[model samples]
Target: MRLFIAIELPDGLKRAFAGLRTPIPGARWVPPEQIHLTLAFLGEVEETAVGHLHDELSRIRIPSFKLRPAGTGCFPGRQRARVLWVGLEPEPHLRDLAAAVQSVLLACGIPQEERPFSPHITLARLKLPAPREVGLFLSGEPKHAFPLVPVREFILFQSRLSSAGAQHVPLHSFPLT
Candidate 1:
């Protein structure tokens, strides 16, 4: 099964992002329901391993923290961009939560990512759209400063790729105290 661990966004934020998607011409916007801040992407794992992964997740202890979506940015240096995302503030607690989740994946024999983690909620994937337009859109600041919201849970999601886009299913959820 294809899986990953992430922090789901609240409904209001999802709606806000959805509104942004309506106008973008060629970019493939992820379904609002699938919008999440992925901490780690565990590409494929044996179905049987899910149980053990859940156990490791259950043992994770992290205190809830507020998350503020600060800015807009793109990945791969924006020269040949692939992903458009909303940048997150450097919240120590959020980083700690991500680290805890990473530890669980490592303990489960999952390979660790060598790249340093940069927390962001992917808004869209650049495909047919002119990358230049994305730069123009990002040239101006976002109208609002989404206030910090408390994050209390991390979810294990299964990604199903389709013609439309990737559909995510929640396999399990673990609460942070």
Candidate 2:
């Protein structure tokens, strides 16, 4: 199964981001329901190994913390932006939690993510190289500061890709104490 671990966004925050979707040509906006802060992406794991993964993840212990969206940016740098996203304020606890998740998954024989952990919610996928308008939008000061929301739990999700875009199914949730 195609799997990943992420923290689900609160309803209020989801609604707030939903309103930020402007009509940018050649960009595909992510649906609010699918918005999440991913900790790790484990691609194509065997069914039998899922049980081990679940067991290890259930033992994760971290204190709950609050997070808020800060500014807008894109992947592969602003000049060659491909994925538009909203940046999250750097929280040490958040990074710790993500590291713990990666450690456990690695012990379970899953390949580690080569890229450094960058916490952001993908807003849209640009079809062509990012246009001047996208740069302009991000250049402005953040129009909104998302309300701080509690992070009480993280979930393991199964991703099924289709023509309609990826469908994320929550398989299990791990609570933060």
Candidate 3:
């Protein structure tokens, strides 16, 4: 199965994120329910391996923490803006949580990501750079767009790919104290 780990957002925040959508020519906004802060993306795993993955994930004991949207930016740089995203206010606890999850994945024989963890919620998939729309969107959004989002749990999600795009289904949830 194609799987990953991430923090789900609250309904109000999802609605607020949806409200940020604009009519940019080559951009597709992420659906409200699909928005999440990804911790690790595990491309594929054997059915038998899932049990071990879930067991390792449950062993994580990070405390819950609050985070908020700080601003917006593009992936692979703005000059080649392929993804538009809302940056999260960095929390050490959040980073530690991600690290713990990664450690578990590595222990389970999952390949490790060479890149460092940079937390952000993807807002749209962009086919081309929409600089004008991006600037307007940034200026319109307050420095801190949403209220503090309490992240009490992270889930191991199964991603089913289809013509309609990817749909995430929670396979198991790991709670934070």
Query: Which of the numbered candidates is closest to the native, going by highest TM-score?
Result: 2
After superposition of all CA atoms, the RMSD between model 3 and the true structure is: 1.4
Task: List model 2 lDDT by residue over 25-107, tens digit each.
Answer: 78888899998898999999998999999999999899999997899888887767789898899988899899999999889
RMSD (Cα, Å) of model 1: 1.8
**lDDT for each of the candidates?**
0.83, 0.88, 0.89
Candidate 1 structure quality by residue, lDDT tens digits, 75-153: 8855567788888888998898889888988899988789988999888887654666777757754675786778999
Q: How many residue pairs clash in each candidate?
A: 0, 0, 0
Root-mean-square deviation of Cα positions for candidate 2 versus the true structure, in angstroms: 1.2
**Mind giving the per-residue lDDT tens digits that candidate 3 earns over 49-150?**
999999988989999999988887778875667788899887999999999998998899999789999999999988888778776776766744589999
Q: Order of candidates by TM-score, top first?
A: 2, 3, 1
lDDT score, candidate 1, position 6: 92
